[model samples]
Target: MSPTTDRTIDFTTGAPVAGSLDVAWVHGAAGEPNLQVHHYDEHTVILRQSKRVTYEAPFLFLLFGEERALLLDTGATEDAELFPLRATVDRLIDQWLERHPREGYGLVVAHTHGHGDHVAADAQFADRPQTAVVAREPEAVRDFFGFGDGWPTGAVTFDLGGRVLDILGSPGHHAAAITCYDPWTGILFTGDTVYPGRLYAFDFPAFRATLDRLVAFAETNPVTHVLGCHVEMKRRRRRDYPIGATYQPAEHRLELTSADLAAVRDAAHAVAGRKGIHRYDNFVIFNEPGKADQLRLLARGRLHQALAKLTRRN
Candidate 1:
C-alpha cells in the first residue's frame, strides 16, 4: 500500500483533528535543558527534552494506554543540576494514574536502549513495586537497573484492556532497540531505530539487520501512526515548542510503506560499499574501514527520504 498521512486526534477533546499541538519549551533550573510534551490523543503522548546549549538533539518519550500506561522511551537524564525534570515526569505519571485510576494497574516502563538519555530515569521507578521494566536483552535490563528479563526477538503482544501493544525487536539503532505497535490506535513507537533526525548506529551491521526486521514487521502490521524517540525541532519547522510535555504525547505521524522500505534497503547497500567517514546530518560517523557502517547509514537515510516523500505526497 502507498504511504499516506492520517489525521491525529486532539488529546483534550478526544476528537480527530488537524494541525500540531502548541508546545511550551521551559528551561529547567540553572539553565538546564528544556522539556516539552505534546498530547495527540487521550491515549498517546510525546515528551521531548532539548539538550541545554546545542538544542541540537532532544530525547523523546511515547506513552500509551490509559489505566495501564506503557512508557515507550523515557527522556534524557535530569541528574545533578537538572533533577526537577525527573520529578516533573514522575508527577505527570502520577497525575495520569489519578485522572484515570486503574486499580492494580501496574506501570510498564520500557527503553530503546541503555543510553543515559533514554534510561536515566529508570531508577525513579525502582521503588514502584507495581512498575515493570521490559528490555530486548537481559544485559540491557541488568546494565540499566539489574532487573527484569529480555523480551523475545520475535513478535510479542501485551494486552491492556481496550489497547493492545505488539513488541517487535529492531536492533539497528542499538543492539537492544525495540519497536512497539498499538493495533487499536495504529501507532508504532520506534525507539532509536527510526526517528526524525540523524540515525546513529553503534554497530552498523546489527542496525541494518534490525531495520530489515522492522521493514518486514511494517509490511505485515497495520501501522498508521509512527512515533520516534526524538524529533528534530528545527526540522519540524514549527514556530514555537510546547511546554509541559506529557507522557505518551504524540508528535509526528509516520508514513511507512513498502516503497519506503525498499528505498531504505537500497541505502543500506550503498553504505556497505563506502569507506572511511560518511557524513550524515550534523555529525560524521566513522565507517570502521569497512562497508558495514556505510550500509547501515545508507539504509537509514533511504528510509528517512522515503518517509519524507510519503509525507509530502500525502
Candidate 2:
C-alpha cells in the first residue's frame, strides 16, 4: 500500500475515518446504559462508562487492526454486573469479527496511565484467552512499551497489524502516564494528563517536560483531536463541575485541538513555580497541590452533591 498525501477516510490502508462526537453522552441519567459505545469508524470505537455507574465515567478506546484489537484503559469499575466493560468489549469484538472475520484474533489491553480510576477493571480481562493485559506499574509500562532505560523520554511505535500508533512516554499527572497518537484518525489519546478537567501535576518538573514534548509532537504530526479520558469542565469558560459530581448537564466537549494543546503547554510554562490550582478557560492546573488543596476540593464536591440533592427534592 502506497502512502498518499491526502488523509481522507481511506480504510483500505488504515487511514482514519471521522466520526461524530455529538452524541448525548450518558450523564448520570436514569436508566442509562452501563457503558456507552460510539463507533468512531468501522475500526475505531470510543466507549464511555456511565456516570450513573461511577463518578469517574472515564472514556475507553478500542481500536481494531488486521490481526488484533487494542483496548486502552479498562475503566473505573471492577464489578461486571455494574460496569459490564468486558462483556461490552466482547460483544463489540464479536460484531467487528462478523464484518471482518478472522481466526485467532487477539486483544492487547493497555492504558494511558496506571491511576486507580483508569486501571481498576483490568481484572475483567485477565483470564480471557488470546488477550495480553499490560500491567499498570511504571516498570511494567516501561517494559511493555519498550521505553527501555529512557523512562520518560522519546517515542515508540506499536503496531496493531497495519494500524501503527505512536506512543510517547508522558509523565506529570502520573509517573507512568503516556499519550498515544493514531495516524489513521489523527486523534491523540492523552488520558488524564491534559484533559479538560483538573490537571493534577504531582511532579511539576516532569509534567512540564511532558507538555513540551506533546506540543512539539502535535506540531509535527497531523493531529485532528486531542482527547482525554474525562471531561470535568462545564460549558462556561474557565468553569469546571465540582469533582466527584455524578450529574453534569453542561459538560464541555471531549475533544481538544492542537491549538488547545499549545494553550495547555503555555499555561504550564506560566505557572512554573505555582503550588496550587491555576484556572484557565479550557483547563485548570493543580500544580503540586498540597493536602489542604485535596481536602478543600473534596469539600466543594460534597457541597455540590448536597445542593444537587436539595434541588432534586424541590
Candidate 3:
C-alpha cells in the first residue's frame, strides 16, 4: 500500500484511518523542528526525530487508550533542548485528552529493543507524573510486560483499556526486542528487527526464529500493515542509503505488508549459514557480521557524506 493522506477516523468504532506518511520527513535541512509528528489515526501518533538533530532519526509511536497511552521508543537523543521529546509528548497527550477526556490518565514509555538510539530519551520521562518508563534491560522489559517463566519465548497481552496489544518476544536485533501487534489498528510495530532497512542479526538464530514467529502470527491475525521504527532503504530495489546519510529524498515507504514479512523470513532462512550482508529488494540482513563489516559500512557512510558535500558545492 502507498502512503495515505486520508486521516479520517471513526472514533466510535475506533477504526483507524490511513494518515499522511508520504511527505518528506526530516531531511537534515536547516530550520526544521527536532521532531516530526504524524497522526496515523485519531488515537495513533507517529513521531520522527530530525536527522539534522541526529542521524539515527528513529521513529516513535504513541497509542492512546481509555486509561493510558503507550509511547514506544523515546528517540535517539537525550538532550531535551535538542529533541524535546517529553515536552512534545506532553503536548500530544494534553491535546488527545481534550478530545477523549479522562482522569489520571497514565503513560507507559517502552521500547522495541534496548538499543541506545531507541531508548536514549528514557531519562526525559523519569520525572513525568503518572508515567512509567520501562527500563532498557531485558529483565525490566520482561517483568513489566509480565513475560513469566517463558521469558523470551511466550506471547502476552497488554491491555491499554479498550486497546489490547499482542506482545511477542522478538529477539534478533537485540535481546530485548519485541514485536507489538495492535488489534485495534491491525498494525504490527516490529521495531528494528524488521524494517525497510538493514536487518542486523547480532544473534542470527534468535532473529530467524523471531521472523518465523512474526510470519506465523500475521497469518492468523488481522494484520493490515507491518510498521517499523526506521526507514533506511531507497526507492530502488536491492539498494539502501549509506548508514549516516541524512537527506533521504527518495527513501522507501515506512509500511511493509505481511507478504514482505514472509519474504524476509524465507530470505533469512536461505542465508542461515551466511556471515555477511544478504541484500534483498526491500531490506538487507546482516548475519553475524564481524568488525570488518562494520568498518566497511562506516567507510561507505563517510564517502556518501563527502559526496553530498561536494555535490552541494558544485
Candidate 4:
C-alpha cells in the first residue's frame, strides 16, 4: 500500500518545503557518517547514528518546538569525548535556531526507553545548559510525566510550546518504554513496542496490555504513522538480519501503518501464553522466556549456542 502521507522513504529524491525536513532517508552504514539527518518538517528531524558506529542502528529524533526542541533516544555509542553527540546536536540546533535567532529555544534530552542502545549517550547531555536529561530510571520518567507511583504504566500529555505530545508509558518491552504521540503530525512513536523488527516481549502480559491500550488510544486519536526507533525488517518482508547482525541490507521503511499495528496486536494476543518466535509478512514477534528457555532455544544451532554464551557474558 502507498503511504498515507509523504514519508521518508523513496517518496522523492529532492528538497522539501521551507522550514520542513527533507524526505531523503539514510541508507547503509558504508561511507555514511555519524548523525545522518532526515528532515521530516520544520519541526521534525530523524537522526540516525549509523550501524557502523553503533550496531543497534537506533534512530534518534529531534523535534523542534517554540520553547525548545526535544531529543528522543541518544545513540548507543558513549564516546562523548570523541563522538560528542551533544555537540553534533548543538551544531544542528544552532543552524535551526539561526532561522529564528531572537526566539528562545531550550533542549530536553529524553529517551524512548532505558535500554543500552537507546540511552547509551545519556551521559553526554547531563550537564548541557537549558537542557534537562530526564532520568532513565522508570520512576524519574513517571514523575516527570506525573504517572504517579504505579507498577505498570499510564498516560500523560507533555506540552512543548505549541506542540502537545501525548506520552503513553509502555512497559513490557522495557520497564520504562514509552510511546510519544505528536498531535501536530499525527505520528505515534512506539519505541520498540511495535517496531518493524523482532517485537521482543520480555513480559508477555504487559506487552499485550500495552498494545491494547495503544489500539484504544489510536482509535480515539488521529494516528497516521506509527514510527519506531529501529528498522530490522528487510524490504522484501518476512526477512531480517540474524541476531546481533550489524549491517542491514535492503532495510524496511521506518514507518508502520495502523493496520500493521492491528496485525501486531493480533499476533501478540494469539501468542499470549506461548513463548517463541512468530514470523509475519512485515516483521517478527518473539517472546523471550527465562534463562532456561533461552538455552533451550539456543540448543538448535551452534551459532545460537555461541550467541547465548555471548549474551550471558554481556
Best by TM-score: 2
lDDT of 2: 0.89
In model 2, residue pairs whose N, Cα or C atoms come closer than 3 Å (at least 3 residues apart or on different chains), thus clashing, are 16-184
Model 3 misplaced regions, further than 4 Å = 1-22
Candidate 2 worst ten-residue window by lDDT? 1-10
* Of candidates 4 and 2, the better by lDDT: 2
List model 4 lDDT by residue over 169-197, tens digit each.
89889998899998777788999899888
Poorly placed runs, candidate 2 (over 4 Å): 1-16
Question: For candidate 2, lDDT tens digit of each residue in 1-314?
Answer: 23422223233453455667767897766778889999887788999998887888999999988778999999988998988889999999998877777779999999999998888899999999999999999889899989897787778988887788999999998878989999888899999988889999999889989999999999898888999999999989999999888888899999999999999999999999879999999999999999999999999999998998999999
lDDT of 3 at 97: 77
lDDT of 3 by residue, 1-314 (tens): 22432223233364444555555676756778889998887788899998888777899999988888999999999999999999999999999877766679999999999999999999999999999999999999899999988679679999787787889999989999999998878899999998999999999999999999999999998788899998999999999999998788888999999999999999999999879999999999999888999999999999999998999999
How well does candidate 2 score on lDDT at residue 152? Answer: 74
Pairs that collide in candidate 4 are 19-42, 20-41, 20-42, 21-39, 21-41
Reference-based TM-score of each model: 0.64, 0.94, 0.93, 0.84
Q: Give the TM-score of candidate 1.
A: 0.64
